[model samples]
Structure formats: C-alpha cells, structure tokens
Target: MRAVSLVPSLSEAVARTAPGVLVGVTDWCTHPAALDAVRVGGTKNPRVELIASLAPDLVIANEEENRAPDLQALRAAGAEVLVTEVRDVPQAFRELARVLDACGVRARPRWLDEAEETWAALPVPDDRLRAVVPIWRRPWMVLGRDTFAGDVLARLGVTPVHADHPDRYPRVPLEELRECGAELVVLPDEPYRFTADDGPEAFPGLPCALVSGRHLTWYGPSLGEAPRVLGRALRAARR
Candidate 1:
C-alpha cells in the first residue's frame, strides 16, 4: 500500500489505519494532518492526474465526496479503490473495518464502543423527540428524510422533521414546520453558521441551539468520540 486519498469524513481513520503509507488528501482533509498535501484537490473535483501519478495501492472514496464521473475515471485508470458509505453508527463501524483492513492497520478506536453505550444510556427527553436542522438559511433548506443528518436524529431517539417540498435540498418554508411541533430546532455552524441573534425567534415557538454540523452528522473516525460529546448535549437539551 503506497498511498491513500480521502474526501469523506476525515483522514484520521485512514492515517491511523495505515500509519506508514503515504496519503494523498484534500486541502479540506483534516483528519490526517500529517498526510501529503501535494496531491491535494477539492472535495469533488480531485486532481486526477496527481492521483494517477501517485500510483497508490488503494484510493478510498465515498458517495458524499467524489462525483460519479471522478470515481469512474479512477476506476478506469486501473486504480484499486475502496468506497466507504457509513450513514449511521453501525454502518460507520463496518466502513472503518474495511478501511482498516485495506490500510493493514489494527487497534480499534476506544471511542467506537463508548459512543454507542453512552447513547443507549442517555435519558430520554420529555420534550418532543423532533428536530429541524437547517442546512441553509437564505433560501432556507433543511435535512430531509434518508440523509445522514436525519438518520443521526433517529439514532438519538429524535425525529427529523422536514417540510414536504420538491427539491432534495428544497427551499423549505417555515410555515410547513408549524405542525411538526418540534421542541428543539438545531442550526448547523457551517455553510451558513447561524446564531441565536440570527433569528431563533423566527421559530419562536421552539427551543433552538447552534450545533456543530460535523458531530451531529459527520460519521467517521471522529464519530468514535464525537457521539459521546453529542450525547451530553442531548442530555443537557433534555434537561
């Protein structure tokens, strides 16, 4: 295994799995800070030429990272590629296992099991187990069904409420949420980092908080410890 590349989650999983191999990662790839940045590329439009030149034994990609065309090109070039698509905890463990096996590394992360156990022991909130995660605000888009964000809430004993609209990333309407009766509305801190002053009153009927988008949604090596952090937050919110 000469090298690896990352686009989804963090390279920490890859680096920890393959400590000795050279890794080609994106400027956005923060998990493995020690990885070679020379072959760095964008999340979707990765430098194909740079990647091909690396002649890596394996290139790890995910549905969320590279586009179909980009992945097709790498495969067409005869590169050995492994795809990780972990939307929830169980899937996350399975993906980690594959990446670990490919990288020839061992030592399961302590956070993995801890996150699950902590989640199971969390006190169920008396508030409505429903939430609204606004991914964008100007046009007002929200996490819809079957998404990573939606699934995270489901695992946390919460329901993700999405307005029925056309686009997958639809410009959701506040009026639509009137019926959800979600006690808590979660606003992410990326792509549109919002604040209480930004307009929690817009949905004045609900209790809201600005949450880290990565922890609530991003499932990766970070998820190992990230879940515990989230568990505490959920408990606090419940209180």
Candidate 2:
C-alpha cells in the first residue's frame, strides 16, 4: 500500500522496514537519506491538497505532531489516516507494530527486536539524579508529565523536576528552571538545538548533559542505539 508519513520517526521506521511503499512524506521526514517521496510539507502545517493529490492508501500521523483539522480533512477526502499516540517506549513499539502491520510488512524488523533487547538489557540506575530537561529556549518549554523523553531518562535513572506538572510540555522561565534544585540539566540538540557551549551556562553550577534529541525523543531505528548513546552522554555530563 502507498503511505504518506507526517511523523519523522514513523517515516524512518516505515522506510527502514519496507522501502518504496511511501509515496509522500513531510519535509522533516529526513531518514534513510535517499528517500524518494513527494514532500508534503512540515509536520504541523502539512499541505493537505498536495497530499490528497498523491492518492496514498494510508496517511500516518501522530496526535502531537499533526493538527486535527488536517487529519479531518484527509479523512473527508476519502483517505485512510492512522493517528498514533505514543507517550512512552512500549506505546511506541505497539504503534510501530500497528503501522507496519497496516503497511503489509509480514515480519517484524530486526531493528525493532534489537531496540527492545537494548532497553531490556539496560540496568536501572541506582543513583538517580533530578534533572530539568528543556526542549525550547525562547519560551523555555520543558519536558513535563508523562513524556516519552522523560520516560527514557527515568529508565536511565534521571527524574524530571516537573514530572508532576499538569502540562506534558510546560513553559517555565530560565531562572525558575535553574532554581528548581535539579542536580543536572539535560539538554537536547533538537527543538532548541542546545549545545555544550550554549545550554550549560544557563544553569551556572549544575552539570549539563548534552544529548541527541533523536535518541531521547524519536521512537524508531534509533531506539536500538539510544540506550548506549544516551547513557554515555548522561555519564559524561559535567559542570
């Protein structure tokens, strides 16, 4: 079946598992490097008319990454849109299976198995550290309650300071984040593109773990290496 993927992680997952099935993808779906598909535009502001013109059998989207009006429009245009909501690792895996099954992939991909085994083999950290993870810097949005990134870090023994907050992604001032009493500040390279030179200084005395956002947030082939990659960054964090 011809599919159009709006989510970057899901796009990569499908491309890795079964190539040539994707007829369209969002501009941000930059995986497999040489993917041959029509650019449907950004995740949030996808080109509905262009996507509809492609005549895909399935359109893959995420509740967070896509807008409701767009999904509604696709369905109204007689397109089968599969909306996925993955709040954590298990949910990600389940959704991946569902999407792949919908795409007619008969067997589970090796990367999926390796990703599960990688996380399964990980030892839960005994020395847990309280961390404030900032995703963006302008409004200073941070990972709050029930986030996939927070879950990934929690597995590695890091607790988010605002994990109890009502908002999944909370807007907190930079000063308040510094004063939150977190032992370390975990900074990701995407959304805000925080670097060792840029993000660490905001916290003054606190240790800063500069991590790959793909490893922390994207739930796909990257999951196979995320544990090891994020583990090293978390361990190597320094003041």
RMSD of each: 3.2, 1.0
Regions of model 1 farther than 4 Å from truth = 8-10, 32-36, 106-128, 163-170, 178-180, 197-201, 235-239
CA lDDT, every model vs. true structure: 0.68, 0.92
Compute the lDDT of residue 63 as modeled in candidate 1. Answer: 78
Model 2: per-residue Cα lDDT over 42-91, one tens digit each: 99899999999999999999999899999999999889999999898888
Q: Pick out the ten consecutive residues of candidate 2 with the lowest summed lDDT.
A: 230-239
- Among residues 3 or more apart in sequence or in different chains, the pairs in candidate 1 whose N, CA or C atoms overlap within 3 Å are none
Error of 1 at 127 (Å): 6.4
In TM-score terms, which candidate is top? 2
Question: What residue pairs clash in candidate 2, if any at all?
Answer: none
CA lDDT, candidate 2, residue 178: 82
Candidate 2 segments exceeding 4 Å error: none
Model 1 scores a C-alpha lDDT of 0.68
What C-alpha lDDT, on a 0 to 100 scale, does residue 200 get in candidate 1?
A: 73
Across 1-239, the per-residue lDDT of candidate 1 in tens digits comes to 76556654646666655566755886666655556545558768888778888888888888776687888888888888787786656676677677766777666666556655665665665544777777877677887755666666666666776633344455667777555667777776754777768747678767776666667766665665555666566667656
